[model samples]
Target: MYRSNVLVCGGTGCTSSNSELIIQRLKEEIAAKGLEQEVNVIRTGCFGLCALGPIMIVYPEGAFYSMVKPDDVPEIVEEHLLKGRIVKRLLYQETVVENSNSVKSLNHTPFYEKQHRVALRNCGVINPEDIDEYIAVDGYQALGKVLTEMTPQDVIDVITKSGLRGRGGAGFPTGRKWLFAAQNQADQKYVCCNADEGDPGAFMDRSILEGDPHAVLEAMAIAGYAIGASQGYIYVRAEYPIAVKRLQIAIDQAREYGLLGKHIFDTDFNFDIELRLGAGAFVCGEETALMTSIEGKRGEPRPRPPFPALKGLFGKPTILNNVETYANVAQIILKGADWFASMGTEKSKGTKVFALGGKIKHTGLVEVPMGTTLREIVEEIGGGVPDGHTFKAAQTGGPSGGCIPASQMDVPIDYDNLIAIGSMMGSGGLIVMDDTTCMVDIAKFFLEFTVDESCGKCTPCRVGTRRLLEILNKITSGNGTLEDIDRLEELCNYLKENSLCALGQTAPNPVLSTLHYFRDEYIAHVTEKRCPAGACKALTNYYILEDKCKGCTLCARNCPVGAISGTVKKPHVIDTSKCIKCGACMEKCKFNAIVKR
Candidate 1:
């Protein structure tokens, strides 16, 4: 056995940060010290704490190293691996207790202590590219049990009893969806996994596919058995290159191991899975649009009553679930419904994984029980908003969801609770905002994303969202009237009512929620022609505070538009007419003299 094992994060976040260089340096160092036989380096997926990556964890000691660089590898190998001395400086601060030489367990850290890892069980634990590592973690055992022991009805019944709702926005009952497809009399039903996570800050789906591709594969095969499906398709976005590459690897491995293709577990049930790469269309996240895209057409939503379960994917009965949803399926089947049902709230069973981003301190991925409060996630788990900035609002569910204001910070995060507060649990993306954020600008930002991503297939999403974007632009640019606010509300409701798909129906959520909670900011923009948060450039004017200015010409020198004029030892003055509101003068002022309002 190897005396020491070194695990390096190979996820997209760490890879972008040159974690690959760290890995290469580690191998070279280990070999140079002639400890290659005693040491092993393994590349794994994300560790959830994206802020501190590229991360390295030395096993046996479990020394969690953050921001590991290529230069640090020699010292780590020579001292830690060769001499067996811990590099206290490079260790994550949370792992080191106050005045204690010994390290704390990585799990006991605040970021991870409150989290419950179900879907992400194998992530950051096993090598995703290796089939043996996944199998050793009991990966395909769920499919084996289902294929050998349980009937199709038995599989469906267990899932139904588990009270597990879909994690992909709508919170529909997964078992009920499966049952509908199972009940339909079709010779060739289909199972699909939606890995097209288009939310701005969401990476939950991509992480799962990259770290635990075999888990999704196993769940898909189980879904096939339960729904009488002979084939399955995973609709993933092309932008997720790591996830796609790893998923394809897992598929090849599963087929080679007889876990996927042609009579899995040596049974008569014949099933297989294929991949369909999408061109990163946000509308394809909706079921009908995803299915249509898989059928070699433009990724656009079709009118419903004929949901994917009844009529989908080439007009046949099909069941589709997203990556996070599928990641939970095998666990629910293996551990029993009661085990899965015991953790969460009454209606929402099982844990939910969220990609926490924006102004939060510890921005990364997190999974908490369904009823966990936003306070716990944002403050305790997320390390709260950074730099003493007060929390303003959190945007959940991307453009398809709404913002949760500070007043609702204590609210429990679940499908029903989120919907009650003018937001939906849209694929578990939670972006925290600071007090500096402009609510009106936030609304406009999401509206712009929706306007760009709308497939133009339906009139409500195509034409209506564009009109809403125009009004928001007019308001931010200091050209809007009070009547424009009323017009926005009216159009929002109209689109919600008349939209053909969920994308259009929920596109106005950000605008509606901001208006409901932060109406003062909007009113200020319209009446005073001033942005309350000073985020809208047209409504903002930057000025130098005479008292705070140190008579330094730094602001004047750095001003790109030559808007600032001052002597070397005197206070600076800004020419507001010439100022582009670019804040270059403010950024150069060391005395904190420049201010915008």
Candidate 2:
């Protein structure tokens, strides 16, 4: 009934930027003017275009405001909410027009011009805290339909035809997993949802659970019904307070509405859900590890003979899926088989949600078709590399993934395509890198993460990954030899061949991928005794270019160690021993004097 609704982002990104204060200010201003009845302020989940947060969208006109601060709220309420005028200065540049109409809305923004939000359909569009809003969007209708009409075989048939795969790193067939649990003859069965997203660059699952929580709830319920289970557990990390809060709210709301618990929709289907908090171990991402964690035991992976669906979660037949995988369940059942299958590529069907981060123009959640090329995603949609640097590599997955070079820029982004080119789809985190990125350092960075995060349950992951880290540390510190490559290759293969779980199995990916794509850089580190990208501090030497130097003395002033010896209007000499390779000299030199060689 309100004439205008000021929607402020309640997602973690904007909330950190003081978006909640903006909402409070707007409410106070509207109430002070006695316009509270006509104007209302609401806090919602992430709007996907995260760079513009703390984002505020004015309704009726759909005027998009990006990066509005706490102080800016009063002006917005007074000028736009009260007087019915638009904030010209605050409007996003891409959507702005001269006059008459408001900016073309978030849909017309350059960053979202090419994004397709299938997996993220109801994410930014609905209030995740409110169960009614999710229901209004046909949220539990799929569960209702599945329970009342469809049989277990029918549910399996629909999902199988849809070609939906697990969105949790390993791309196993979702229907097949359910069928395995359904076929089992255990006295009791259970379903579990993996919400412990541990990848550094990944937030796709977190966003879905935060934005459209009911979708996961409904999907889990349907999964429970489909697999002949009466109980479920969501293994989520306690670190994600926002996501945890929304999920708890959704569960309570579902129970209140009879969407969960005994006799769901009066169909003799008695089911309920519980939550188990993860201590935030990366190894718990593995199926056996996750089930073990759910049982309050030490989280680690075990060899797979009888997978989770056959015998899991306290020795009960259990089917496990990650947040993103479960998020697609209701849609696949409601929209039919071919509808979901029609999207993505042959091997990988249905769109995948990617957490686009690291050096890209747009760093947020994106869901694109499977066959979408890496070039189109980075250049056309990601706005290419920020600051006009040439694209070097993109690291997909997380510490477990690999760095992709520019040579495979046109490779179709799918499961097989990525694995074939020494990379994997992982759980959909695409981190863009530019020429300034050092491949050796990047590989070392990921390997270091793998080494620290390894559960030590297996010798391959615990011992081999640690040894790989030592070699990477040696190479970066300028102590490597040409024979190190052969040695590193030997270790990587040994780890791969003798790994216990997927964590140990893919631990050597980053090292192998970088070595395959940027071998010249590795050779330079050994033969030329230099870091090609000037990233490894020990192998790099910084010097101010005398010809390019205008003798501004900015480098000398900015250098923390006073490495540059220079006087005004005279060329400078860098004391190499005193230089720290922090790039302060390069940042201060306006004339491009500070050079890395």
Candidate 3:
């Protein structure tokens, strides 16, 4: 019964920015003012606007504060908490009404306006560590409903009707996977969750586990019942300390409440879950590899003829879904399948959560209905490319996905649509690029990651990706021929066709997509030995503009190799032989006289 509730973000993004200290300071300030009973401070999950973290929100008034520092606590406490005055200067600019003292709801802001949170519904709204807070929001009601009323087949049918697809890269049908597992009769069946989110610039799954661990736990229980499994395991990477800690807490709390262990709701059904920490192997994100890692073996992908649903997790029938996919199950069960189906496109039904990042103004977690245009996400929601930079291209699906040129920005974002445009909805990582970004370099970067992360279980991913890297290196180093470009395409096709697993099969996506869309950049790199975006050092040179340079001798002084030779008030010239291409001279030049060519 507090008059004011201060919700401080405790998610990883905010925690890194010192939100924990903000919470502690808020409590101390509240106690010193003797408003402890009247004021309540709670630590919650990510609010999705990660750019403006360590975010703080004061409820009853809903004053949204961004990038809060420890020193600012007193003013917030005295002026806003004690005196009831809004902290105008500290508030998120988007929430502040222009020319008026009034503020708008956070939902109405451009960053959040287009977002329709389904998997992220409970995130940031409740304290994930407290089971009571979770229960207050109809947390385990879906498990209760499924356990008490619906048949196992009925549960499968409802999920099948919902059109929910796996959020872990492949976009496979959730219901179909469940049905396959349910049909298989085994003495032991296993349910596994893939929290080993390895995609670059992606944190959607991690945020869900941090913000709403119960949603995933409850969903796993329902899945266990539906698939006739008593034991469940979550394969999470050791990197996500917060998610892992909160998940363990949620599991303990649920078992203590008789919601997880033994006969739940006094029914004959019995189920439980456990955690298996991974050593951060990127390939282990694959279903078979994840399960294999759980079995205490080196994480590597197993060929799929009998997929996880048919034979998995120690040679037993198993169903494995990622954290985000499980996060949606309970909702689909409670809200009904049609309710979920009504939102997304016909083929790609339900909402999709994306870890929106890179070059975008608003870099954070965003959940939107399937088929939402990339333009809507980039221009309207993400606030477009920052610093007056023109939009160039967007990379989705991490190392496994392709680049979508600006020409295809309007294409509806869905499983089929993205696949149609040479990209796939792989785990929902949307990285926006600006005009300055080199598409060829972008492809090379992703390819390098793939080459480093390859499990070495197969030659295509292990050796082929290495050969591809060499070719890209040659091109970027300003020594490549037209034949080399053709060779790259040939090798890419071979890897896609002959690879042992999805890891190898999709490894060429970045290279192939860039070659298809930004072929001019590739040709320029080979033909003219020039990186059009001036990204590759070997292909670019820095020069001081004669008209712009005041010959302040700044460039010469800043050059580490003394490459720039010039006097005060005279045009500077760079000695290309001595230049390291470090761009130090360009960075120090205040005249904006330096240009890369």
* Number of the top lDDT candidate: 3
Cα lDDT, all candidates: 0.92, 0.87, 0.93
**Residue 107 CA error for candidate 3 (Å)?**
1.5
| TM-scores, each model vs. reference | 0.99, 0.98, 0.99
lDDT of 2 at 108: 70
lDDT of 2 by residue, 1-597 (tens): 988877788888888899878888888888898997898777788888787788888888989898899898788888888788899788877778887656686677667767778778887677889888888888789998998899989999899889999998889999988888899887789989999999997888888878888888888888888888999999999988999998999999999999899999999998999888999899999989999988888998978877777779898899999998988889888889999999989999988888888888877887788888888888877778888689999999887789888999999898899999999999888999988888989989888888888999887789999889888888888889888888999999998899999898998999999999999988888888888788888998898788988888888898899888978999998999988889988987789777888
Query: Which portions of model 2 show Cα errors greater than 4 Å?
Result: none
Error of 3 at 123 (Å): 1.2
User: Could you tell me the lDDT of residue 467 within candidate 2?
Assistant: 88
Segments in model 3 whose C-alpha atoms lie over 4 Å from true places: 98-101
TM-score of 2: 0.98
Clashing pairs in model 3, backbone N/Cα/C closer than 3 A: none
- Of the pair 1 and 3, which is ahead by lDDT? 3
Question: Given candidate 2, what's the lDDT at residue 307?
Answer: 78
